[model samples]
Target: MAGAVTTVTTLSNEARPKHLTEPRPVRYLLIAVALLFIGIVVVLPMLTVLLEAFRKGWSAYIEALKDPDAMAALRLTLITALIAVPLNTIFGVAAAWAITKFKFRGKNLLVTLIDLPFAVSPVISGLVYILLFGAQGFFGPWLMDHDMKIVFATPGIVLATMFVTFPFVARELLPLMEAQGVQDEEAAVSLGSKGWRTFFKVTLPNIKWGLLYGIILCNARAMGEFGAVSVVSGHIRGETNTLPLHIEILYNEYQYTSSFAVASLLMLLAIITLVIKGLIEGKLARSRHGQ
Candidate 1:
């Protein structure tokens, strides 16, 4: 009887609404629209950056990159990202564990605070730090009295990057950790495993992909942060200027090729970010199905 029913179901499946690989007319229309939008919105700008960078030829592009200020800006950007990404990654993990593993008062409020950076403008993020640390500002006198400079220095830049990228890892991990449940962790505890050991051995493995996804996001934002970094960097030549600020300085100096060349580095970063995000997301999807 089961075989007979299966044969009947297979016979019904042999009928086609459309070919197995084919889309309906509506689907085709949607696919075309999506492609066209991507072309206009994403592809076009990227092409423009590449074109502008090489427009004045290889010598110009090389020269642009070789500029002392440009080199310094590039270094500063990388340094900021290195500092910000790790700190944020640790924070993200701790926040996710705390919020997802424990039942506590004001949990919702804590989650909202984690998302504060995403909701606030990057410009505002930078400005808030400046208000607190800028000369003639809140802590300005004390900081100056102690000869500590943050408002327009490396520390300020790092702080701004941190503020903007703060949410990425936590946001990425929260839902995933929640979905993963705490059963394994609880069991690990019952077996005499310590908290740190359980986290490193069990929780970390389960959430590795999500955590990496968040780290990538955090790194990208830290490197590309503009509005906030701009507000705080003070554009002091090589000393305080990050890449985005360097690009602005070049543009203002009428070094169009140099500006675009520097800008192209950021564009490449964005592309790499998208590619990595896609790969991680694919892995995540596969793992979900495997489970």
Candidate 2:
């Protein structure tokens, strides 16, 4: 008994790692490489944006952001996100529910179609819209007769953003909802719960975190989207330009500091998105642990 107790104490006292630990030099080299990589890829660009934005002065930066064109871009971007994110959120939840809960033909094909935007180039996606709606394109004659504008307008911009952001929430929720199974939902139904009630009380609570995660990604993509929106937006100054497009216009017009100032807003938005997403993930982790 004493011998067993001594062995147990010795084992308990040993601070052995589960895997073979690297040498101090190797471990340090890995950490240095990671830090250097992050500095080069992430830190440097952010620092550059900040420095350039303030190069002229705080007054200059503020003035740049307050420009009429910049203000329009900001407003258009907010409106676009306001429309696009919620639309996609609803579609994502519905699509995820149907795809995860129902047995249907062409299921894999539906998933692939949902993810098709990711595989397609953004520039090409824009071109496809233009072809379908441009003045010389397929529906152009009919639209002209009706005096409808699709390409080079707000509608086109919203549509392009929608296409790109479509898959985010659905993809995030699918696996999670699948893992949760339908047991709870079926039980809810058997207990005389209505369909909407069953969904809100059972399904929504389970996937809300994943849904929020998807929304964050979708909002970021929608706001920062350039190539696709650019193709159809016509970059018509205060009329159609989104923030990224406005930054390009500023840069081309030789207003480098002001352009950087606008870019800084985008960077700030990205940081905020990341912070919120991290908080949501931390909460989810803690809730799972408590359960």
Candidate 3:
């Protein structure tokens, strides 16, 4: 029994310490560093904005919210997101379907082209639109001759946003569709269902959550877009201004409090989007389990 106890003790001593007892200091150091970084970078900046937004009291907050230009900017931002997100969602779904469900020549080339915008800078994208629609651009004179306006306008803003957000939904949907496979689609077709019917009934159900998630991402990007919008937008107040652009103008004019107020609103929107995305992913999980 003494020998047995000695052998067991020897084996236990030979084993390295488990995680709970091993290097407690290192774990605490890592956690301290992470907390310090979060406090300095994220928490401090957010608190500053919150304080600025409410500095003049609740009445000032209400006044800023009710400002006509602010209201208009908010409305325009929502409208542009509404239009752009849907268009991109449709394009994304179709592009994903073609890329994943079909085998064709130049397939790789086409996908590379579709993902091109992601590699390109937003400023470059804005420049491309300017070259296409600006006064001295290729189509500029012709468009002007017809009394058309694109640059420095709402249409230009939407187009720029759409360009930037084009990849979101397609990128999201492609993997999901590819993984789900063509078996269900083949089975549907075999049963005499038409292509569109099969897609809506069989394919869409499986990828709906993913599609919604992409749309949410697209919407957020559209609403918060600044660099490209600033390039094309003349920054016309209440006319062509988006919320982000409005915030920029406010800051440039030294209205720091108002700037952070609008920024806080946008931050709230971003948080809401995250919440929605979480809900969507949860629903998707439940759906897969149900299947």
Candidate 4:
């Protein structure tokens, strides 16, 4: 009996993957390689942006950011995020709830459409809006007749941003909502709770962290989006240019310090987003474990 038990133990150990049983040296080497890669890809570029932004002096860096065009770009970027993030968050939550908590016709189609933005390139996404709204395009005459402009205007910029960042929140929540299942929602319904009550009480608490995570990612993408916004913005300097487009204009005009200074703002935003995302992820992990 003891020999049989020993054989079972040996077999179980052997069934584990070799990588999981690697030597300490190999483990340390892998960790070192991962750290090196992150340093090269992420940390180095951030440091470079900061270093170059203030290369001249603190005064120059401050002056660069205080430029009228730069301030305009900053405000435009903020307005875009303020409009885009909340709208996408609402859409994402609705899409996630519909796809996860209920079953209906065209479910697969709904999911595919949710993923459509990710499958398409940013530049192509911009061009699609232009084709629909450009002065020479399909709705051009109708829009002109109505004296309404959608392309190469603020509306165009917002639309492009919405398209590019559409997938982030939904994609984040889909798998999470799926894993939580529908039992809790069903219980709430059986207990005489209304739809919105159940959602606000039971559903929201369960998925809040995942929702926040998705919102952060969505906001980050919206603010940093360049290709799509650039194509539709007409780069009208202070009028339509967002921060990324403004940075490009500055760089093109050989204003390296100013460009880096503007770039630094984006870099700071990215860093803050990453930090918040990490904290939210930690909270999410704890909540899941508690469940």
Misplaced by over 4 Å in model 4 are: 1-28
Give all candidates' CA lDDT scores: 0.86, 0.86, 0.84, 0.88
lDDT of 1 by residue, 161-260 (tens): 9988888888888878898889999999999999899999989988887788888777877898889999998889989999999999888999888899
Against the true structure, candidate 3 reaches a TM-score of: 0.89
lDDT of 2 by residue, 1-291 (tens): 111111101113554584777777888899899999999999999999999999999999999999999999999999999999999999999999999988899999998888888877889878888999999899999999999998899999998999877788788777677777788899999999999999999888887787888898789989999999999999899999999999999999999999999999999999998888777776656544443
What would the TM-score be for candidate 4 when compared with the true structure? Answer: 0.90
* lDDT score, candidate 3: 0.84
Which residue pairs show backbone clashes in model 4?
Answer: none
**Ranked candidates, highest lDDT first:** 4, 2, 1, 3
- TM-score list, all predictions: 0.90, 0.92, 0.89, 0.90
lDDT of 3 by residue, 139-238 (tens): 9999999999999998999999998888888877876787787999999999999989999999998899888888888888889988888888888999
What is the number of backbone collisions in each predicted candidate, taken in the order shown? 0, 0, 0, 0
- Candidate 3 residues lying further than 4 Å off, grouped into runs, are 1-22, 285-291
Q: Which 10 successive residues of model 1 have the least lDDT summed?
A: 1-10
Cα-lDDT of candidate 4? 0.88
Q: Candidate 1: misplaced stretches above 4 Å?
A: 1-28
Error of 4 at 98 (Å): 1.0
lDDT of 4 by residue, 87-199 (tens): 99999999999999888999989888788888788898799999999998899999999999887889999999999988788887887899899999999999999999999
Highest lDDT model number: 4
